[model samples]
Target: MHVFLIAALSADGFIAKTVDQISTRWTSKEDAAFFAQKTKEAGVVVMGRTTFETIGRPLPDRKTFVYTTRELLGFPPELVEATQLPPAELLAKLEAEGYTQVAICGGSQVYTKWMQSGLIDKIYLTIEPVFFGTGIRLFTEEITNTIRLKERHLLSDQTTVLEYEVLR
Candidate 1:
Protein backbone atom coordinates (compact mmCIF):
# COMPACT_ATOMS: atom_id res chain seq x y z
CA MET A 1 0.00 0.00 0.00
CA HIS A 2 1.07 3.57 -0.67
CA VAL A 3 0.91 5.65 2.52
CA PHE A 4 1.10 9.44 2.44
CA LEU A 5 0.65 12.19 4.97
CA ILE A 6 -1.68 15.08 4.14
CA ALA A 7 -2.09 18.38 5.97
CA ALA A 8 -2.93 22.04 5.46
CA LEU A 9 -0.87 24.63 7.20
CA SER A 10 -0.69 28.35 7.75
CA ALA A 11 1.90 30.26 5.78
CA ASP A 12 4.13 30.15 8.83
CA GLY A 13 3.94 26.33 9.09
CA PHE A 14 1.40 25.84 11.86
CA ILE A 15 -1.42 23.45 11.26
CA ALA A 16 -3.91 25.13 13.59
CA LYS A 17 -4.12 27.76 16.26
CA THR A 18 -5.24 25.31 18.93
CA VAL A 19 -5.87 21.66 19.51
CA ASP A 20 -9.57 21.92 18.76
CA GLN A 21 -9.38 24.28 15.84
CA ILE A 22 -11.15 22.87 12.85
CA SER A 23 -9.11 23.04 9.65
CA THR A 24 -11.99 24.36 7.59
CA ARG A 25 -11.89 27.52 9.68
CA TRP A 26 -8.66 28.67 8.05
CA THR A 27 -8.08 26.50 5.00
CA SER A 28 -9.44 27.74 1.72
CA LYS A 29 -12.46 26.07 0.13
CA GLU A 30 -10.24 24.96 -2.73
CA ASP A 31 -8.09 23.10 -0.29
CA ALA A 32 -11.11 21.47 1.27
CA ALA A 33 -12.34 20.38 -2.13
CA PHE A 34 -8.90 19.06 -2.98
CA PHE A 35 -8.78 17.12 0.27
CA ALA A 36 -12.17 15.56 -0.33
CA GLN A 37 -11.23 14.54 -3.81
CA LYS A 38 -7.95 12.84 -2.86
CA THR A 39 -9.11 11.06 0.26
CA LYS A 40 -12.25 9.87 -1.46
CA GLU A 41 -10.12 8.43 -4.19
CA ALA A 42 -7.91 6.73 -1.58
CA GLY A 43 -10.95 5.19 0.17
CA VAL A 44 -9.28 5.13 3.62
CA VAL A 45 -7.88 7.68 6.03
CA VAL A 46 -5.95 7.49 9.31
CA MET A 47 -5.77 10.26 11.88
CA GLY A 48 -4.99 10.98 15.50
CA ARG A 49 -7.65 11.16 18.20
CA THR A 50 -7.74 14.94 18.39
CA THR A 51 -8.11 15.30 14.67
CA PHE A 52 -10.99 12.84 14.66
CA GLU A 53 -12.68 14.62 17.54
CA THR A 54 -12.46 18.01 15.88
CA ILE A 55 -14.11 16.65 12.79
CA GLY A 56 -16.68 14.96 15.08
CA ARG A 57 -17.70 12.30 12.63
CA PRO A 58 -16.44 9.76 10.18
CA LEU A 59 -15.68 11.32 6.84
CA PRO A 60 -18.34 10.34 4.39
CA ASP A 61 -17.36 7.88 1.63
CA ARG A 62 -14.16 6.79 3.36
CA LYS A 63 -13.33 4.49 6.24
CA THR A 64 -11.60 6.31 9.08
CA PHE A 65 -9.05 4.65 11.34
CA VAL A 66 -8.20 6.55 14.49
CA TYR A 67 -4.71 5.79 15.78
CA THR A 68 -5.26 5.69 19.51
CA THR A 69 -5.87 3.40 22.42
CA ARG A 70 -9.14 5.02 23.40
CA GLU A 71 -12.18 3.01 22.54
CA LEU A 72 -13.87 4.90 19.76
CA LEU A 73 -17.40 4.96 21.10
CA GLY A 74 -20.53 6.02 19.20
CA PHE A 75 -19.01 5.64 15.74
CA PRO A 76 -20.52 3.23 13.30
CA PRO A 77 -18.54 0.00 13.01
CA GLU A 78 -18.50 0.12 9.27
CA LEU A 79 -17.31 3.70 9.06
CA VAL A 80 -14.75 4.01 11.85
CA GLU A 81 -12.25 1.86 13.70
CA ALA A 82 -9.67 2.44 16.41
CA THR A 83 -6.08 1.32 15.89
CA GLN A 84 -2.78 1.40 17.71
CA LEU A 85 -0.71 -0.59 15.32
CA PRO A 86 2.59 0.87 14.22
CA PRO A 87 2.66 2.59 10.87
CA ALA A 88 3.81 -0.45 8.93
CA GLU A 89 1.42 -2.81 10.68
CA LEU A 90 -1.53 -0.53 10.20
CA LEU A 91 -0.64 -0.15 6.56
CA ALA A 92 -0.41 -3.89 6.29
CA LYS A 93 -3.90 -4.33 7.73
CA LEU A 94 -5.39 -1.72 5.46
CA GLU A 95 -3.64 -3.18 2.47
CA ALA A 96 -4.92 -6.61 3.42
CA GLU A 97 -8.38 -5.13 3.43
CA GLY A 98 -7.82 -4.11 -0.20
CA TYR A 99 -7.10 -0.41 0.12
CA THR A 100 -4.53 0.73 -2.42
CA GLN A 101 -3.70 4.11 -0.98
CA VAL A 102 -3.84 5.32 2.63
CA ALA A 103 -3.97 8.97 3.66
CA ILE A 104 -2.62 10.09 7.02
CA CYS A 105 -4.94 13.00 7.79
CA GLY A 106 -3.47 14.15 11.02
CA GLY A 107 -2.79 16.33 14.01
CA SER A 108 0.85 17.03 14.91
CA GLN A 109 1.30 13.94 17.02
CA VAL A 110 0.14 11.56 14.34
CA TYR A 111 2.17 13.34 11.70
CA THR A 112 5.33 12.97 13.72
CA LYS A 113 4.64 9.33 14.47
CA TRP A 114 4.12 8.34 10.87
CA MET A 115 7.07 10.37 9.68
CA GLN A 116 9.30 8.76 12.25
CA SER A 117 7.99 5.39 11.28
CA GLY A 118 9.70 5.90 7.93
CA LEU A 119 6.83 4.45 5.97
CA ILE A 120 5.29 7.50 4.39
CA ASP A 121 6.02 7.59 0.69
CA LYS A 122 4.68 11.06 -0.02
CA ILE A 123 3.42 14.22 1.61
CA TYR A 124 0.71 16.54 0.30
CA LEU A 125 0.62 19.90 2.01
CA THR A 126 -1.72 22.78 1.25
CA ILE A 127 -0.29 26.12 2.19
CA GLU A 128 -2.95 28.74 2.77
CA PRO A 129 -2.43 32.47 2.62
CA VAL A 130 -2.67 33.04 6.36
CA PHE A 131 -0.35 33.36 9.29
CA PHE A 132 -0.68 32.03 12.82
CA GLY A 133 2.47 33.11 14.61
CA THR A 134 2.14 30.39 17.18
CA GLY A 135 0.16 27.22 16.98
CA ILE A 136 0.38 23.48 16.53
CA ARG A 137 3.21 22.43 14.23
CA LEU A 138 3.12 20.10 11.28
CA PHE A 139 5.00 17.62 13.45
CA THR A 140 5.27 17.85 17.21
CA GLU A 141 8.68 16.18 17.50
CA GLU A 142 11.96 16.44 15.70
CA ILE A 143 12.21 14.42 12.50
CA THR A 144 14.45 14.52 9.49
CA ASN A 145 13.83 13.25 5.99
CA THR A 146 14.69 14.23 2.45
CA ILE A 147 11.66 14.83 0.30
CA ARG A 148 11.93 15.59 -3.39
CA LEU A 149 9.39 17.90 -4.94
CA LYS A 150 7.09 16.08 -7.29
CA GLU A 151 4.33 18.50 -8.10
CA ARG A 152 3.08 21.99 -7.36
CA HIS A 153 -0.62 22.60 -7.78
CA LEU A 154 -2.11 26.06 -7.70
CA LEU A 155 -5.45 25.51 -6.08
CA SER A 156 -6.24 29.21 -6.17
CA ASP A 157 -4.49 32.50 -6.58
CA GLN A 158 -3.36 32.39 -2.95
CA THR A 159 -3.47 28.71 -2.08
CA THR A 160 -0.94 26.19 -3.33
CA VAL A 161 -0.62 22.46 -2.88
CA LEU A 162 2.88 20.98 -2.75
CA GLU A 163 3.40 17.33 -3.39
CA TYR A 164 6.70 15.64 -2.61
CA GLU A 165 8.11 12.18 -2.76
CA VAL A 166 9.37 11.17 0.68
CA LEU A 167 12.66 9.71 -0.37
CA ARG A 168 13.94 7.06 1.94
Candidate 2:
Protein backbone atom coordinates (compact mmCIF):
# COMPACT_ATOMS: atom_id res chain seq x y z
CA MET A 1 0.00 0.00 0.00
CA HIS A 2 1.14 3.52 -0.79
CA VAL A 3 0.72 5.44 2.44
CA PHE A 4 0.74 9.23 2.44
CA LEU A 5 0.21 11.64 5.32
CA ILE A 6 -1.56 14.99 5.16
CA ALA A 7 -1.45 17.55 7.94
CA ALA A 8 -1.70 21.27 8.62
CA LEU A 9 0.75 22.48 11.18
CA SER A 10 1.99 25.74 12.60
CA ALA A 11 5.33 27.22 11.67
CA ASP A 12 6.72 25.62 14.82
CA GLY A 13 5.49 22.21 13.66
CA PHE A 14 2.54 21.79 15.96
CA ILE A 15 -0.50 19.96 14.63
CA ALA A 16 -2.82 20.72 17.51
CA LYS A 17 -2.97 22.40 20.89
CA THR A 18 -4.41 19.30 22.49
CA VAL A 19 -5.53 15.80 21.72
CA ASP A 20 -9.18 16.89 21.49
CA GLN A 21 -8.44 19.97 19.47
CA ILE A 22 -10.52 20.64 16.40
CA SER A 23 -7.82 21.04 13.76
CA THR A 24 -9.87 23.21 11.43
CA ARG A 25 -10.17 25.81 14.15
CA TRP A 26 -6.50 26.78 13.77
CA THR A 27 -5.68 25.52 10.28
CA SER A 28 -6.05 27.92 7.38
CA LYS A 29 -8.90 27.78 4.91
CA GLU A 30 -6.49 26.93 2.13
CA ASP A 31 -5.12 23.97 4.06
CA ALA A 32 -8.63 22.81 4.85
CA ALA A 33 -9.47 22.85 1.15
CA PHE A 34 -6.32 20.97 0.28
CA PHE A 35 -6.93 18.37 2.99
CA ALA A 36 -10.47 17.83 1.80
CA GLN A 37 -9.38 17.34 -1.76
CA LYS A 38 -6.61 14.92 -0.81
CA THR A 39 -8.75 12.85 1.53
CA LYS A 40 -11.49 12.51 -1.06
CA GLU A 41 -8.98 11.23 -3.58
CA ALA A 42 -7.51 8.68 -1.16
CA GLY A 43 -8.75 5.10 -1.22
CA VAL A 44 -8.60 4.75 2.55
CA VAL A 45 -8.35 7.23 5.42
CA VAL A 46 -6.69 6.10 8.67
CA MET A 47 -6.46 7.98 11.94
CA GLY A 48 -6.08 7.33 15.64
CA ARG A 49 -8.94 7.25 18.07
CA THR A 50 -8.39 10.79 19.30
CA THR A 51 -8.19 12.16 15.78
CA PHE A 52 -11.36 10.32 14.82
CA GLU A 53 -13.21 11.70 17.81
CA THR A 54 -11.95 15.17 17.10
CA ILE A 55 -13.20 14.88 13.54
CA GLY A 56 -16.56 13.93 15.08
CA ARG A 57 -17.85 11.87 12.15
CA PRO A 58 -16.84 9.58 9.35
CA LEU A 59 -15.99 11.10 6.01
CA PRO A 60 -18.52 10.52 3.26
CA ASP A 61 -18.03 8.06 0.38
CA ARG A 62 -14.78 6.61 1.72
CA LYS A 63 -13.79 3.92 4.18
CA THR A 64 -12.29 5.37 7.38
CA PHE A 65 -10.22 3.13 9.59
CA VAL A 66 -9.67 4.38 13.10
CA TYR A 67 -6.84 2.53 14.79
CA THR A 68 -7.30 2.20 18.51
CA THR A 69 -6.33 -0.42 21.03
CA ARG A 70 -9.73 -0.22 22.68
CA GLU A 71 -13.17 -0.13 21.18
CA LEU A 72 -14.96 3.11 20.57
CA LEU A 73 -18.61 3.89 21.22
CA GLY A 74 -21.21 6.38 19.96
CA PHE A 75 -20.66 5.66 16.27
CA PRO A 76 -22.06 2.87 14.23
CA PRO A 77 -19.64 0.24 12.89
CA GLU A 78 -20.78 1.01 9.36
CA LEU A 79 -19.74 4.64 9.63
CA VAL A 80 -16.26 3.85 10.89
CA GLU A 81 -14.27 0.67 11.37
CA ALA A 82 -12.27 0.43 14.58
CA THR A 83 -9.20 -1.75 14.37
CA GLN A 84 -6.42 -2.71 16.75
CA LEU A 85 -4.15 -4.09 14.08
CA PRO A 86 -0.64 -2.70 13.85
CA PRO A 87 0.39 -0.66 10.84
CA ALA A 88 1.82 -3.61 8.94
CA GLU A 89 -1.21 -5.81 9.39
CA LEU A 90 -3.55 -2.96 8.56
CA LEU A 91 -1.67 -2.21 5.37
CA ALA A 92 -1.69 -5.87 4.42
CA LYS A 93 -5.41 -6.06 4.98
CA LEU A 94 -5.99 -3.00 2.84
CA GLU A 95 -3.72 -4.35 0.15
CA ALA A 96 -5.59 -7.63 0.15
CA GLU A 97 -8.78 -5.64 -0.35
CA GLY A 98 -7.21 -3.86 -3.39
CA TYR A 99 -6.66 -0.41 -1.97
CA THR A 100 -4.01 1.56 -3.81
CA GLN A 101 -3.56 4.63 -1.65
CA VAL A 102 -3.91 5.29 2.06
CA ALA A 103 -4.06 8.62 3.85
CA ILE A 104 -2.58 8.59 7.35
CA CYS A 105 -4.11 11.49 9.21
CA GLY A 106 -3.01 11.83 12.81
CA GLY A 107 -2.83 12.49 16.49
CA SER A 108 1.00 12.40 16.75
CA GLN A 109 1.18 8.89 18.17
CA VAL A 110 -0.30 7.33 15.07
CA TYR A 111 1.91 9.39 12.79
CA THR A 112 5.05 8.44 14.68
CA LYS A 113 4.06 4.80 14.91
CA TRP A 114 3.54 4.49 11.16
CA MET A 115 6.72 6.37 10.34
CA GLN A 116 8.72 4.30 12.79
CA SER A 117 7.39 1.25 10.96
CA GLY A 118 8.47 2.85 7.66
CA LEU A 119 4.96 2.73 6.30
CA ILE A 120 4.68 6.32 5.09
CA ASP A 121 5.47 6.92 1.44
CA LYS A 122 4.77 10.66 1.08
CA ILE A 123 3.98 13.63 3.21
CA TYR A 124 1.80 16.60 2.30
CA LEU A 125 2.16 19.38 4.83
CA THR A 126 0.48 22.76 4.94
CA ILE A 127 2.49 25.25 6.98
CA GLU A 128 0.09 27.78 8.34
CA PRO A 129 1.29 31.32 8.95
CA VAL A 130 0.79 31.13 12.67
CA PHE A 131 2.74 29.76 15.61
CA PHE A 132 1.57 27.83 18.62
CA GLY A 133 4.27 28.62 21.19
CA THR A 134 3.66 25.23 22.77
CA GLY A 135 1.40 22.39 21.75
CA ILE A 136 1.26 18.90 20.33
CA ARG A 137 3.91 18.41 17.68
CA LEU A 138 3.56 16.64 14.33
CA PHE A 139 5.74 13.73 15.41
CA THR A 140 7.05 13.05 18.86
CA GLU A 141 9.28 10.11 17.97
CA GLU A 142 12.54 10.69 16.16
CA ILE A 143 12.55 10.11 12.38
CA THR A 144 16.03 10.24 10.90
CA ASN A 145 15.33 9.81 7.18
CA THR A 146 15.50 12.42 4.46
CA ILE A 147 12.56 13.27 2.24
CA ARG A 148 12.84 14.53 -1.31
CA LEU A 149 10.77 17.54 -2.16
CA LYS A 150 8.21 16.76 -4.83
CA GLU A 151 6.19 20.00 -5.07
CA ARG A 152 5.56 23.32 -3.42
CA HIS A 153 2.50 25.51 -3.79
CA LEU A 154 1.79 28.93 -2.36
CA LEU A 155 -1.82 29.07 -1.43
CA SER A 156 -3.93 32.11 -0.83
CA ASP A 157 -3.61 33.82 2.57
CA GLN A 158 0.10 33.07 2.68
CA THR A 159 -0.33 29.39 3.40
CA THR A 160 2.33 27.12 1.88
CA VAL A 161 1.88 23.48 0.93
CA LEU A 162 4.91 21.23 0.72
CA GLU A 163 4.85 17.72 -0.68
CA TYR A 164 7.72 15.32 -0.19
CA GLU A 165 8.56 11.72 -0.97
CA VAL A 166 10.08 9.92 1.98
CA LEU A 167 13.32 8.26 1.02
CA ARG A 168 13.41 4.76 2.39
Model 2, 1-168: lDDT tens digits are: 679988888899899977888899988877887887888787579999899889889888678899888877777676689988889999998899888888999879888888888879899989988888889998987988679999998888589999999998
Using alpha carbons, what is the TM-score of model 2? 0.94
Q: Tens digits of per-residue lDDT for model 1 on 1-168?
A: 788899998999999999999999999999999999999999999999999999999999999999888898999989999999988898888889999999999999999999999999999999999999999999878889899999999999999999999998
- Worst 10-residue lDDT window for candidate 2 reads 70-79
Per-model TM-score on C-alpha atoms:
0.98, 0.94
lDDT of each: 0.93, 0.86
Clashes of each: 0, 0
Which residue window of length 10 is worst by lDDT in model 1?
86-95
* lDDT at position 154, candidate 2: 88
